[model samples]
Target: MVRIACLILALILPALVAADVADVYDFSDRAQEQRYRNLIAELRCPKCQNQNIADSNAPISKDMRDVVYRMMNDGASNEEIVESLVGRFGEFVRYKPEFDSRTFLLWATPAIAVFGGLLVVAGVVIRSRRSGSESPALSAEEKARVDKMLADQDRPS
Candidate 1:
């Protein structure tokens, strides 16, 4: 029993000792550290859609963190650093991609769809109104036929 317990402990000990090395970010200054954390939080982890690179545990997240840190240490401004990364990875890396020609539809598509739906609804309303106006003056023969049908129904029980 003691030997079995010892084996179990040994097995578990190695697993516990193997730490996740990607969480550590070495920044020389508090400001740079804050900037690095902020940028990483704003940037999406390509491997994990729901998490920012700062909070992700994936290797790709670590690599992205390293890239941001390197750019910061090189004295790049926050905007410049973000631009550099965006340039390398494209708009998909950003939590909010910029609105440009290719992505114009992204921001405007919903509004355009709403406008189109309104136009369709207006067209249907206008068409219905036009049809109602044109048919208001039913032919005398049609009115006589409708009156005979009503008279027959009225004469029944």
Candidate 2:
């Protein structure tokens, strides 16, 4: 009887787990609900870099989803909603960052780093070729000494 009770409890335990998802939308129109899903998928969870608000377990993500749901219910446009979030959290909260003078560095930094690496590689290759092509100069006395050593070596075993 004790084993059967434990097995029943084990089977029922999974039913108690709750994800903090917002109430399912009962929008008069279907498109608005779709838009809400898309918007939540686009917004990054602040506490979790790799997860969107829809998929994140963080309370912040749940709160952000609630905000998005409320904004959609209030008839806010997608752009307006996104702008509100960006205004509060800066551009980092959005998966797609907007282009502006301030973000030029963010977009250009990787290309600049690649170009800098290529220049360094080219400089190293050029320097190595230059070094390898230069023959060491020998004094006449040094050449004579080298020749003498060769001659001695060749004379007998």
* Model 1 residue pairs with clashes: none
lDDT of 1 by residue, 118-151 (tens): 9999999999999888856779999999999999
Model 1's lDDT to the true fold?
0.85
Most accurate candidate by lDDT: 2
Per-residue C-alpha lDDT of model 2 across residues 1-157, encoded as one tens digit per residue: 9999999999878766653434566777778878988999999988897789889878987888888889988889999998998888778888878878988998899999999999999999999999999999999999999999999999977
Candidate 1 deviant stretches above 4 angstroms: 1-9, 26-32, 138-157
- Cα error, residue 93 of model 1, in Å, equals 0.3
Model 2 C-alpha lDDT versus the unseen true structure: 0.87
TM-score of 2: 0.68
Per-candidate Cα lDDT values, in order, are: 0.85, 0.87
Tell how far residue 24 is off in model 1, in angstroms. Answer: 2.7
